[model samples]
Structure formats: structure tokens, C-alpha cells
Target: MTVLLTVLAGLGLGLSLIVAIGAQNAFVLRQGLRGEHVGLVVAVCAATDVTLIFAGTAGVGVVLERAPVVVDVVRWAGAAFLAGYAVLAARRALHPGALRAGTEGARVPAARVLTAVLALSWLNPHVYLDTVLLLGSVAGSHGGDRWWFALGAALGSITWFTLLGVGARWLRPFFARPAAWRLLDAGVAVVMATLAVLLVLRPV
Candidate 1:
């Protein structure tokens, strides 16, 4: 019973940390909506989160806390990437493309998708701060149960990403129109631009 409760606590915290309107989530949603390589995108995000959570439970957060410069480098790189992504989204919004459901449109190479997702997953410093530092520290508080906490966190991440990627197909009807795509792209642009600015001002 105690172990189950600890796992649940970790799950809740993991979900709380990720269920936000950030660059990573935005990119995932976009890929989900497009129905292009959703599996790969979700896999990368979930795997990265799980790996970092476990690393934190293993006391990597201590190393990170002692190395502020690493976080700064990621912050700057992430900001630049987000800024560039914002520009691309803005351009897409200006000239909205047709919504491609499943295998309906020109396929984006899987390799390209892989690269984009990898960048989005690794470049963001918040991933380190949240999964590595916050989650790690929290897991450590559980001592012997820390592994259970990490497991719960990993499960939370996997469940969320899987649901997000798979469930987005249900909204295909709504995204069928070019106008809807335009609106989504515009929102993505705004979100990415705002996040980029925030990272610059308060790099975490």
C-alpha cells in the first residue's frame, strides 16, 4: 500500500510537470494532428522523459545542480530553436497547408521527423530541471522506494504521450479544413515565440 501510494505520487507529479503548453507538447500536438510519424515522436518524448527521471533517481540531479553552465547552454540553444520554429509556424500560418490525415498527403521523411523530435527533446533545459532535478530530488526523498517513484513517472509519461499521439486522430475531422490548420499553426507560432522569450528572460 505504501509503495502504491508513492508510485501514485510520482505519477501525479510527472503528469503535472508535462501537461503544459510548452514547445515540446506543441510540437507533439502538431505532429499528432498531421498524423505524421506520431509514434516516433511520442516514443522519443516518452523515452527521453523516462530516461531523465531514472537518471534523477540515480542522483544525476546532484551533478546537474553543480553544473549550471550546462543548463545555460541548453537554454540558449533551445531558445534559438524555438525562435526558428516559431518563424516556420508563422510562415505556415500565413500560407496554411492542407491537412493530411494518415497517409493522405506528401509524407515527411521519418529521418527528418526523428531529427526534429530529438532536438526538441534534448535542447530544452526544462526537461533536465523537471525530470532530472525536481523529479529526481522528489524520488530521492522516497529512499528505497525511489525506483518505484521513477517507474511511476515513466508510466505517466508513456501514458500521456501515447494518448496524445493516438487520440489526436479523432480530431482529424476538425482539422480537415485549411483554415483550422492555419489557426493551429498560428497558435503554435505564438506559443513557441512566447516560450522562447520566457527561456531567455528566466532560463530554467
Candidate 2:
């Protein structure tokens, strides 16, 4: 019963953090709508979150909490990755046919999609704070049953991403036009760039 309660608490916290509209979610939705590797994208996001949550529950998060230099390194790397992705997104927007052509020709390479998803999920400071620090701290409060809390948090991530990807895919027909794709890509580019700037400016 204690574990169940802890799981519920973790679920609530994880959902609260993830449900917000952010660069990560925006990118996922855009990719899903584009009929990209939606399942792979969702799986990567969920798996990354679960892994971090597990680490946090296992007390690795506490070690990271005390390592200022490590945190700084992660922050900078994440910012650089996001910035690079933003540039790619902008270029895609400008060219217009690149993404569509890629989608048409070769199914957008599973490895490339997985790498992008990993970068988006693992490289973000917000993800660390939300899944590793914040959720981990909350789970740690459960004493020996912290794993239950981590399980709950993992469930939240899985549920949310699955829903987002599946739901967005259902809207594919509505957003099938070239102009719509261009608008979505442009929006993704702006959000990703803004997130990169914010991450860079954040105090280490």
C-alpha cells in the first residue's frame, strides 16, 4: 500500500511536469504529425525518462546533486545539442521539401530518429531536473520504497508520450498540406531555438 501511494504521488508529479507545452513536447507532436517514426520517438522519450527516474531512485541522483561541475557540463552539452537541432529545423523549414522528401524516400532512418529523440530527451536540463532531481527527491522521501515512486513516474512518462504520439498521428490528415507542414516546422524551429537560448543563459 505504501508503494502504491508512492507510485501515485510520483505519477502526479511527473504528469504535472510533463503535461506542459514545451520544446520537447512540441517537437514530438510535430514529428508524429509528420508521420515520422512516431513509435520510435515515443519509445525513446519514455525509455530515457524511465532510466533517469530509476537512477534517481537508486541514489545516483544524490551523487549528481552534489556534483556542480557535472551539472554544468550536462547543461552546456544539452544547450549545444538543442542549438544544433534548432538550426537543422530552421534549414528544413527554409527548404520545405527536405523533410517530406526524406520521409518519402527512405522512412527517415530509424537510427537518426532515435538519435534525435535521445538528444531531445537526454540533453535537456529540464528533463534532468524533472525526472532526476525533482522526481528522485520526491521518491527518496519514500525511504526503502523509493523504487515504487520511480515506477509511478515512469508510468506517467510512458502514458503521456504514448498518448501524445498516438493522438497527434490521428490528426495527420488535418495537417497534410505543404503549408501546414511548413508552419509546423517553423514553429518547432522557433521553440527549439528559444529553449537553447534559455538553457545557455541559465546559471550553472
lDDT of 2 at 166: 78
Runs of candidate 1 exceeding 4 Å displacement:
97-105
Instruction: Return the TM-score for each candidate structure.
Output: 0.95, 0.89
Whole-model alpha-carbon lDDT for candidate 1 = 0.88
Model 2 C-alpha RMSD to native: 2.0
Q: Give Cα-based local distance difference scores for all models.
A: 0.88, 0.81
| Model 1 Cα lDDT, one tens digit per residue, 1-204 | 999999999999999999988888888887898788999999999999999999999999999889999999999999999899899888877753432332246788999889888988999998998999999999999999999999999999999989888888898999877788888888989998998999999868
Candidate that would win on TM-score: 1
lDDT of 1 at 85: 86
